[model samples]
Target: MKPLFMLLLTYLLCWQVSLGQQNSYTGNGQVTFSAGAPLDLIKGTSTAITGSINQVTGKVYFEIPVKSFQFANSLMEERFNNKYMKTDRHPKATFIGEVTSFSQNSKEVTAHGILSIHGVSKRRSIKGTLVKEGGKFILKSGFVVSTKDHHIESPKLTGGFMAEHINVNLHLQLIPENVTPQVATVYPAKKGLK
Candidate 1:
Protein backbone atom coordinates (compact mmCIF):
# COMPACT_ATOMS: atom_id res chain seq x y z
CA MET A 1 0.00 0.00 0.00
CA LYS A 2 2.78 2.43 0.88
CA PRO A 3 4.57 1.63 -2.38
CA LEU A 4 1.44 2.36 -4.39
CA PHE A 5 0.98 5.67 -2.57
CA MET A 6 4.58 6.68 -3.30
CA LEU A 7 4.15 5.85 -6.96
CA LEU A 8 1.04 7.98 -7.16
CA LEU A 9 2.80 10.91 -5.52
CA THR A 10 5.69 10.69 -7.96
CA TYR A 11 3.31 10.54 -10.88
CA LEU A 12 1.44 13.62 -9.66
CA LEU A 13 4.67 15.60 -9.30
CA CYS A 14 5.79 14.75 -12.81
CA TRP A 15 2.40 15.63 -14.20
CA GLN A 16 2.48 18.99 -12.51
CA VAL A 17 5.89 19.80 -13.95
CA SER A 18 4.76 18.85 -17.42
CA LEU A 19 1.66 20.99 -17.08
CA GLY A 20 3.73 23.99 -15.98
CA GLN A 21 6.02 23.68 -18.95
CA GLN A 22 3.10 23.46 -21.33
CA ASN A 23 1.48 26.54 -19.82
CA SER A 24 4.08 28.99 -21.16
CA TYR A 25 5.17 29.54 -24.76
CA THR A 26 7.44 31.94 -26.67
CA GLY A 27 8.01 32.38 -30.39
CA ASN A 28 8.43 34.59 -33.43
CA GLY A 29 5.85 35.27 -36.12
CA GLN A 30 4.82 37.46 -39.06
CA VAL A 31 2.77 40.64 -39.23
CA THR A 32 1.28 42.44 -42.19
CA PHE A 33 -0.43 45.81 -42.58
CA SER A 34 -2.35 47.26 -45.51
CA ALA A 35 -3.82 50.70 -46.00
CA GLY A 36 -6.00 51.39 -49.00
CA ALA A 37 -7.11 54.77 -50.22
CA PRO A 38 -9.26 55.63 -53.19
CA LEU A 39 -6.33 55.87 -55.54
CA ASP A 40 -3.48 53.97 -53.89
CA LEU A 41 -2.78 50.98 -51.66
CA ILE A 42 0.09 50.75 -49.17
CA LYS A 43 1.15 47.41 -47.75
CA GLY A 44 4.03 46.13 -45.65
CA THR A 45 5.18 42.88 -44.10
CA SER A 46 7.44 42.19 -41.14
CA THR A 47 8.72 38.88 -39.84
CA ALA A 48 10.31 40.38 -36.72
CA ILE A 49 7.33 39.75 -34.47
CA THR A 50 8.05 38.17 -31.10
CA GLY A 51 5.51 37.14 -28.53
CA SER A 52 4.78 35.02 -25.51
CA ILE A 53 1.70 33.51 -23.91
CA ASN A 54 0.94 32.13 -20.51
CA GLN A 55 -1.97 29.73 -20.90
CA VAL A 56 -2.62 29.27 -17.23
CA THR A 57 -2.94 32.99 -16.53
CA GLY A 58 -4.26 33.90 -19.99
CA LYS A 59 -1.56 36.55 -20.38
CA VAL A 60 -0.32 37.43 -23.87
CA TYR A 61 2.26 39.89 -25.15
CA PHE A 62 3.69 40.74 -28.55
CA GLU A 63 6.25 43.21 -29.90
CA ILE A 64 7.42 44.34 -33.32
CA PRO A 65 10.12 46.80 -34.26
CA VAL A 66 8.82 49.71 -36.28
CA LYS A 67 11.77 49.73 -38.65
CA SER A 68 11.42 46.03 -39.35
CA PHE A 69 8.43 46.46 -41.64
CA GLN A 70 9.20 46.26 -45.38
CA PHE A 71 7.25 47.99 -48.11
CA ALA A 72 7.24 47.54 -51.88
CA ASN A 73 8.27 51.13 -52.41
CA SER A 74 11.39 52.48 -50.78
CA LEU A 75 9.91 55.94 -50.55
CA MET A 76 6.92 54.63 -48.71
CA GLU A 77 9.15 52.78 -46.27
CA GLU A 78 11.25 55.83 -45.60
CA ARG A 79 8.21 58.02 -45.13
CA PHE A 80 6.62 55.48 -42.82
CA ASN A 81 9.62 55.28 -40.48
CA ASN A 82 10.78 58.89 -40.45
CA LYS A 83 7.71 61.00 -41.10
CA TYR A 84 4.72 58.94 -40.00
CA MET A 85 5.73 56.37 -37.42
CA LYS A 86 8.73 58.31 -36.12
CA THR A 87 10.70 55.16 -35.56
CA ASP A 88 13.58 57.12 -34.09
CA ARG A 89 11.41 58.19 -31.19
CA HIS A 90 8.94 55.31 -31.05
CA PRO A 91 10.94 52.29 -32.04
CA LYS A 92 8.48 49.51 -31.37
CA ALA A 93 4.79 48.65 -31.26
CA THR A 94 3.49 46.29 -28.61
CA PHE A 95 0.36 44.65 -27.32
CA ILE A 96 0.00 43.48 -23.75
CA GLY A 97 -3.19 41.87 -22.58
CA GLU A 98 -4.99 38.84 -21.30
CA VAL A 99 -6.99 36.20 -23.07
CA THR A 100 -10.48 37.08 -21.95
CA SER A 101 -12.14 34.01 -23.45
CA PHE A 102 -10.47 30.80 -24.50
CA SER A 103 -11.45 27.17 -24.73
CA GLN A 104 -9.36 24.19 -25.61
CA ASN A 105 -12.29 22.60 -27.39
CA SER A 106 -12.77 25.67 -29.57
CA LYS A 107 -10.43 27.67 -31.75
CA GLU A 108 -11.93 31.10 -31.07
CA VAL A 109 -10.21 33.37 -28.57
CA THR A 110 -10.55 36.97 -27.46
CA ALA A 111 -7.79 39.09 -25.94
CA HIS A 112 -8.47 42.33 -24.09
CA GLY A 113 -5.48 44.56 -23.49
CA ILE A 114 -3.61 47.72 -24.33
CA LEU A 115 -2.05 48.28 -27.72
CA SER A 116 0.74 50.82 -28.00
CA ILE A 117 1.89 52.28 -31.29
CA HIS A 118 3.77 55.45 -32.10
CA GLY A 119 3.98 56.12 -28.37
CA VAL A 120 0.22 56.05 -28.03
CA SER A 121 -1.54 53.46 -25.93
CA LYS A 122 -5.17 52.46 -26.30
CA ARG A 123 -7.40 49.82 -24.85
CA ARG A 124 -8.31 47.24 -27.45
CA SER A 125 -10.07 43.95 -27.59
CA ILE A 126 -8.72 41.74 -30.33
CA LYS A 127 -10.45 38.55 -31.44
CA GLY A 128 -8.42 35.72 -32.87
CA THR A 129 -8.21 31.95 -33.25
CA LEU A 130 -5.89 29.59 -31.45
CA VAL A 131 -5.11 26.10 -32.63
CA LYS A 132 -2.97 23.57 -30.84
CA GLU A 133 -1.08 21.15 -33.06
CA GLY A 134 1.85 18.88 -32.27
CA GLY A 135 2.58 20.63 -29.00
CA LYS A 136 2.54 24.11 -30.51
CA PHE A 137 -0.07 26.84 -30.60
CA ILE A 138 -0.87 28.66 -33.81
CA LEU A 139 -2.58 32.03 -33.38
CA LYS A 140 -4.21 33.92 -36.24
CA SER A 141 -5.92 37.28 -35.96
CA GLY A 142 -7.01 40.28 -38.06
CA PHE A 143 -7.91 43.76 -36.93
CA VAL A 144 -8.08 47.33 -38.13
CA VAL A 145 -6.13 50.22 -36.61
CA SER A 146 -7.16 53.82 -36.84
CA THR A 147 -4.54 56.40 -37.69
CA LYS A 148 -6.12 58.99 -35.44
CA ASP A 149 -6.16 56.62 -32.51
CA HIS A 150 -2.40 56.21 -32.71
CA HIS A 151 -1.72 59.83 -33.55
CA ILE A 152 -0.46 58.98 -37.03
CA GLU A 153 -0.93 61.89 -39.39
CA SER A 154 -2.05 61.24 -42.90
CA PRO A 155 -0.10 62.66 -45.83
CA LYS A 156 -2.49 65.36 -46.97
CA LEU A 157 0.03 66.62 -49.47
CA THR A 158 -0.13 63.27 -51.28
CA GLY A 159 -3.81 63.73 -52.11
CA GLY A 160 -5.22 61.05 -49.80
CA PHE A 161 -2.75 58.37 -50.69
CA MET A 162 -3.16 56.80 -47.26
CA ALA A 163 -6.31 55.57 -45.62
CA GLU A 164 -7.63 56.52 -42.21
CA HIS A 165 -7.67 52.94 -41.06
CA ILE A 166 -5.15 50.21 -41.68
CA ASN A 167 -5.87 46.49 -41.82
CA VAL A 168 -3.45 44.34 -39.82
CA ASN A 169 -2.97 40.57 -39.84
CA LEU A 170 -1.06 38.27 -37.54
CA HIS A 171 0.08 34.67 -37.91
CA LEU A 172 2.12 33.21 -35.05
CA GLN A 173 3.20 29.76 -34.01
CA LEU A 174 4.27 29.55 -30.37
CA ILE A 175 6.27 26.72 -28.92
CA PRO A 176 7.14 25.85 -25.36
CA GLU A 177 9.77 28.22 -24.04
CA ASN A 178 11.92 25.40 -22.78
CA VAL A 179 12.29 23.94 -26.24
CA THR A 180 14.79 25.45 -28.67
CA PRO A 181 13.00 25.82 -31.97
CA GLN A 182 14.54 27.01 -35.21
CA VAL A 183 13.37 30.61 -34.83
CA ALA A 184 12.69 31.00 -31.14
CA THR A 185 13.32 34.59 -30.08
CA VAL A 186 11.60 36.75 -27.48
CA TYR A 187 12.00 40.50 -27.17
CA PRO A 188 12.97 41.99 -23.87
CA ALA A 189 10.45 44.23 -22.18
CA LYS A 190 11.00 47.92 -22.64
CA LYS A 191 10.89 50.50 -19.87
CA GLY A 192 7.60 52.38 -19.25
CA LEU A 193 5.85 50.18 -21.82
CA LYS A 194 4.35 47.82 -19.26
Candidate 2:
Protein backbone atom coordinates (compact mmCIF):
# COMPACT_ATOMS: atom_id res chain seq x y z
CA MET A 1 0.00 0.00 0.00
CA LYS A 2 1.12 3.56 -0.73
CA PRO A 3 2.45 5.49 2.23
CA LEU A 4 -0.60 7.16 3.84
CA PHE A 5 1.31 10.37 4.71
CA MET A 6 2.62 10.75 1.17
CA LEU A 7 -0.84 10.29 -0.31
CA LEU A 8 -2.32 13.03 1.96
CA LEU A 9 0.49 15.44 1.14
CA THR A 10 -0.02 14.95 -2.58
CA TYR A 11 -3.76 15.58 -2.28
CA LEU A 12 -3.23 18.84 -0.33
CA LEU A 13 -0.67 20.16 -2.77
CA CYS A 14 -2.95 19.56 -5.74
CA TRP A 15 -5.87 21.29 -4.03
CA GLN A 16 -3.78 24.36 -3.24
CA VAL A 17 -2.56 24.66 -6.82
CA SER A 18 -6.06 24.21 -8.21
CA LEU A 19 -7.13 27.29 -6.27
CA GLY A 20 -4.28 29.40 -7.64
CA GLN A 21 -4.48 33.14 -7.08
CA GLN A 22 -2.38 36.22 -6.49
CA ASN A 23 -1.27 37.82 -3.20
CA SER A 24 -2.67 41.33 -2.96
CA TYR A 25 -4.30 43.79 -0.54
CA THR A 26 -7.02 46.40 -1.17
CA GLY A 27 -7.25 49.84 0.55
CA ASN A 28 -10.28 52.14 0.73
CA GLY A 29 -11.39 55.45 2.26
CA GLN A 30 -13.07 58.81 1.42
CA VAL A 31 -12.00 62.40 0.70
CA THR A 32 -14.31 64.70 2.69
CA PHE A 33 -13.85 68.34 1.81
CA SER A 34 -15.29 71.88 1.94
CA ALA A 35 -13.92 72.63 -1.58
CA GLY A 36 -13.17 76.17 -0.34
CA ALA A 37 -16.96 76.72 -0.64
CA PRO A 38 -18.61 73.33 0.07
CA LEU A 39 -20.77 73.26 -3.10
CA ASP A 40 -20.84 69.50 -3.29
CA LEU A 41 -17.63 70.19 -5.16
CA ILE A 42 -15.67 67.30 -3.71
CA LYS A 43 -15.00 63.83 -4.99
CA GLY A 44 -15.91 60.89 -2.81
CA THR A 45 -14.50 57.37 -3.04
CA SER A 46 -14.69 53.69 -2.11
CA THR A 47 -11.78 52.31 -4.10
CA ALA A 48 -10.26 48.87 -3.87
CA ILE A 49 -6.61 49.97 -3.93
CA THR A 50 -4.77 46.85 -5.16
CA GLY A 51 -1.15 46.58 -4.04
CA SER A 52 1.41 45.13 -1.71
CA ILE A 53 3.14 46.67 1.29
CA ASN A 54 6.63 45.48 2.05
CA GLN A 55 7.24 45.90 5.74
CA VAL A 56 10.99 45.66 5.26
CA THR A 57 11.28 48.23 2.47
CA GLY A 58 8.06 50.27 2.94
CA LYS A 59 6.93 50.51 -0.69
CA VAL A 60 3.29 50.99 -1.78
CA TYR A 61 2.04 50.32 -5.30
CA PHE A 62 -1.53 51.34 -6.12
CA GLU A 63 -3.53 51.89 -9.31
CA ILE A 64 -6.79 53.52 -10.40
CA PRO A 65 -8.30 53.80 -13.87
CA VAL A 66 -9.19 57.14 -15.43
CA LYS A 67 -12.67 55.97 -16.40
CA SER A 68 -13.44 54.82 -12.87
CA PHE A 69 -14.18 58.32 -11.64
CA GLN A 70 -17.93 58.92 -11.21
CA PHE A 71 -20.01 61.96 -10.42
CA ALA A 72 -23.01 62.61 -8.19
CA ASN A 73 -24.89 64.48 -10.88
CA SER A 74 -25.24 64.17 -14.65
CA LEU A 75 -23.72 67.60 -15.16
CA MET A 76 -20.78 66.68 -13.02
CA GLU A 77 -20.17 63.56 -15.04
CA GLU A 78 -20.22 65.36 -18.38
CA ARG A 79 -18.07 68.15 -17.03
CA PHE A 80 -15.45 65.64 -15.99
CA ASN A 81 -15.36 63.11 -18.80
CA ASN A 82 -16.46 65.30 -21.70
CA LYS A 83 -14.52 68.36 -20.73
CA TYR A 84 -11.57 69.06 -18.43
CA MET A 85 -10.18 65.61 -17.58
CA LYS A 86 -10.43 63.83 -20.96
CA THR A 87 -10.37 60.45 -19.22
CA ASP A 88 -11.38 58.58 -22.36
CA ARG A 89 -8.05 59.20 -24.07
CA HIS A 90 -5.81 58.80 -21.08
CA PRO A 91 -7.12 55.69 -19.38
CA LYS A 92 -5.41 55.22 -15.99
CA ALA A 93 -3.38 56.77 -13.21
CA THR A 94 -0.93 54.76 -11.15
CA PHE A 95 0.82 55.47 -7.87
CA ILE A 96 4.18 53.90 -7.23
CA GLY A 97 5.28 55.54 -4.04
CA GLU A 98 7.13 54.75 -0.84
CA VAL A 99 6.23 55.17 2.78
CA THR A 100 9.52 56.57 3.91
CA SER A 101 8.52 57.00 7.56
CA PHE A 102 5.84 55.88 9.96
CA SER A 103 4.90 57.17 13.39
CA GLN A 104 3.28 54.05 14.90
CA ASN A 105 6.81 52.79 15.03
CA SER A 106 4.72 51.46 12.07
CA LYS A 107 1.24 52.93 12.33
CA GLU A 108 1.06 56.20 10.37
CA VAL A 109 3.41 56.59 7.45
CA THR A 110 4.28 59.48 5.17
CA ALA A 111 3.60 58.48 1.52
CA HIS A 112 5.27 60.50 -1.18
CA GLY A 113 4.94 59.87 -4.89
CA ILE A 114 4.02 61.16 -8.33
CA LEU A 115 0.35 61.78 -9.18
CA SER A 116 -0.23 61.85 -12.94
CA ILE A 117 -3.37 63.42 -14.40
CA HIS A 118 -4.44 65.40 -17.46
CA GLY A 119 -1.23 64.24 -19.13
CA VAL A 120 0.78 66.07 -16.49
CA SER A 121 2.59 64.43 -13.63
CA LYS A 122 3.33 66.10 -10.33
CA ARG A 123 5.32 64.97 -7.33
CA ARG A 124 3.07 64.94 -4.30
CA SER A 125 3.89 64.36 -0.66
CA ILE A 126 0.91 63.27 1.40
CA LYS A 127 0.46 62.34 5.05
CA GLY A 128 -1.24 58.94 5.16
CA THR A 129 -2.81 57.36 8.25
CA LEU A 130 -3.02 53.61 8.26
CA VAL A 131 -4.65 50.96 10.43
CA LYS A 132 -4.33 47.23 10.08
CA GLU A 133 -7.37 45.50 11.55
CA GLY A 134 -7.17 42.01 10.12
CA GLY A 135 -6.67 40.89 6.51
CA LYS A 136 -7.06 44.50 5.37
CA PHE A 137 -5.54 47.98 5.42
CA ILE A 138 -7.15 51.46 5.42
CA LEU A 139 -5.52 54.59 3.97
CA LYS A 140 -6.75 58.20 3.94
CA SER A 141 -5.09 61.26 2.39
CA GLY A 142 -5.95 64.56 0.65
CA PHE A 143 -4.16 67.49 -0.94
CA VAL A 144 -4.92 70.82 -2.59
CA VAL A 145 -4.35 71.36 -6.33
CA SER A 146 -4.99 74.16 -8.75
CA THR A 147 -6.59 73.28 -12.07
CA LYS A 148 -4.67 76.01 -13.79
CA ASP A 149 -1.36 74.44 -12.90
CA HIS A 150 -2.26 71.24 -14.75
CA HIS A 151 -3.58 73.25 -17.70
CA ILE A 152 -7.16 72.18 -16.95
CA GLU A 153 -9.10 74.92 -18.66
CA SER A 154 -12.59 75.28 -17.23
CA PRO A 155 -15.20 75.17 -20.00
CA LYS A 156 -17.41 78.09 -20.93
CA LEU A 157 -20.64 76.43 -19.80
CA THR A 158 -19.99 77.34 -16.22
CA GLY A 159 -21.42 80.70 -15.23
CA GLY A 160 -18.24 81.32 -13.34
CA PHE A 161 -19.14 78.21 -11.34
CA MET A 162 -15.91 76.30 -11.33
CA ALA A 163 -13.36 77.03 -8.64
CA GLU A 164 -9.81 77.91 -9.60
CA HIS A 165 -8.33 75.44 -7.15
CA ILE A 166 -10.08 72.23 -6.17
CA ASN A 167 -9.56 70.23 -3.03
CA VAL A 168 -8.66 66.61 -3.89
CA ASN A 169 -9.05 63.86 -1.35
CA LEU A 170 -8.42 60.13 -1.24
CA HIS A 171 -9.87 57.79 1.41
CA LEU A 172 -9.24 54.16 0.60
CA GLN A 173 -9.41 50.61 1.93
CA LEU A 174 -7.68 47.56 0.50
CA ILE A 175 -8.12 43.80 0.83
CA PRO A 176 -6.31 40.78 -0.55
CA GLU A 177 -7.08 40.79 -4.32
CA ASN A 178 -7.09 37.04 -4.58
CA VAL A 179 -10.35 37.14 -2.64
CA THR A 180 -12.18 39.67 -4.82
CA PRO A 181 -12.35 40.22 -8.59
CA GLN A 182 -13.36 43.21 -10.77
CA VAL A 183 -13.32 45.35 -7.66
CA ALA A 184 -14.54 48.85 -8.50
CA THR A 185 -13.32 52.17 -7.04
CA VAL A 186 -15.68 55.14 -7.41
CA TYR A 187 -14.90 58.82 -7.01
CA PRO A 188 -18.01 61.08 -7.23
CA ALA A 189 -16.14 64.37 -7.34
CA LYS A 190 -13.52 63.10 -9.71
CA LYS A 191 -14.29 65.80 -12.28
CA GLY A 192 -10.54 66.05 -12.70
CA LEU A 193 -9.96 62.44 -11.72
CA LYS A 194 -7.62 59.59 -12.60
In order, candidate lDDTs are 0.88, 0.60
- Candidate 2 lDDT over 1-194, as tens digits, reads 23455566666665564344323454544443223344445453424334455554567776666556665666766766767778777665556788897887657678788766677777877676777767677776667767776777654323556666766667667665554223223324444443
Q: Please give, for residues 164-188, the per-residue lDDT of candidate 1 as tens digits.
A: 8989999999998783223323344
User: TM-score for all predictions?
Assistant: 0.80, 0.65
Q: Candidate 2 overall Cα lDDT vs. reference?
A: 0.60
In Å, residue 44's CA in model 2 sits off its true spot by 5.5
**After superposing candidate 1, which stretches have Cα over 4 Å from the reference?**
1-19, 156-162, 179-194
lDDT of 1 at 193: 64
User: How well does model 1 score by local distance difference test?
Assistant: 0.88
